[model samples]
Target: MNTQMTYTAFLDEQCLASGPLVDVATAIQQHANQSNATVLIFNDQTGKQIDLDISGSKQDIQQRYAEHPETVKKVGRPKLGVISREITLQQRHWDWLDQQSSSASAVIRKLIDKELNDPNSESNKMLAKQATDRFMSAMLGNMPNYEEATRALYQGNKEVFLDLIRDYPKDIYQHILKLSAYAF
Candidate 1:
């Protein structure tokens, strides 16, 4: 539920629109009204296709797709954007945490932040590869040399991947390159 998340829409292999959900929804609604072309919308962050109800007026579409701020009551410091969740730890782990000067939550947050900030971390690299793969699978699944291009992607052979997809549609080629920039 990331409110700031952006989306990209494609009509066949041609990119149609890309922006916030509301803007994209309106664009899709207008395009859909004018043509019977099939438009696929994707969550940019996860490279996953999403279905949106765009059968309405522009205002209706915008209202329906716009992000509404949540009003849920948080257990921790709401002003600081802290949320509380339950976690189970082993007795030995709890004992060790209890001996630390900082709270266990603070210690855990630091550890997570450290990992998140490390762009070269294995987990981050894997996530980048997975995202690139997902996008490629969706957009280039039927294209020529798809299998070889995918292999090159996972193998971290940027040159080979680029060469394999060199003849793809310009928009798709650029988008694939952008999405897979970190994969290698």
Candidate 2:
């Protein structure tokens, strides 16, 4: 039986491997079964299964797997890369926040269900993109310290945001307080 396989279908580079031959064979077999292409596999004493090396972002790969369920299940597991965006707003921003996040399209919808349901909701902050944008814009044209600090946060630099949070803790505390009243 000849198990000679070429995974050029996934990548341009010539791949040399001596393991997980089964997984590749299985994946090919599944694709062949579903398509007009001819796929042949000979299961022998040498057992091997390795993931087919495909190059793409996690989100792109997940989308590919979603489109080809049978093929993915036959050979490999799709990796999930989720990003959680967190925002912190004050408890005093309820009226407007509630009205905004309640709408189905609002990205902050999940935060509202979790925080704004109870009358005595103590959530001082929220987690969302809108909140982050609002927070950044509010810091514009303020005192030099606040202006500089807020500028770094909105500039989309992770290191700057982290540093600002650490160096100017008082500013953050105050800014969040002011924005609390208008987080709609």
**Candidate 1 lDDT by residue in tens digits, 91-152:** 99999889989999998888877876676677666666787778888988988999999899
How many clashing pairs in candidate 1? 0
Query: What TM-score does candidate 1 get on C-alpha atoms?
Result: 0.83
Error of 1 at 3 (Å): 11
Maximum-lDDT candidate: 1
Identify the runs in model 1 with alpha carbons over 4 angstroms from their true place.
1-4, 74-83, 89-101
User: How close is every model to the real structure, measured as TM-score?
Assistant: 0.83, 0.20
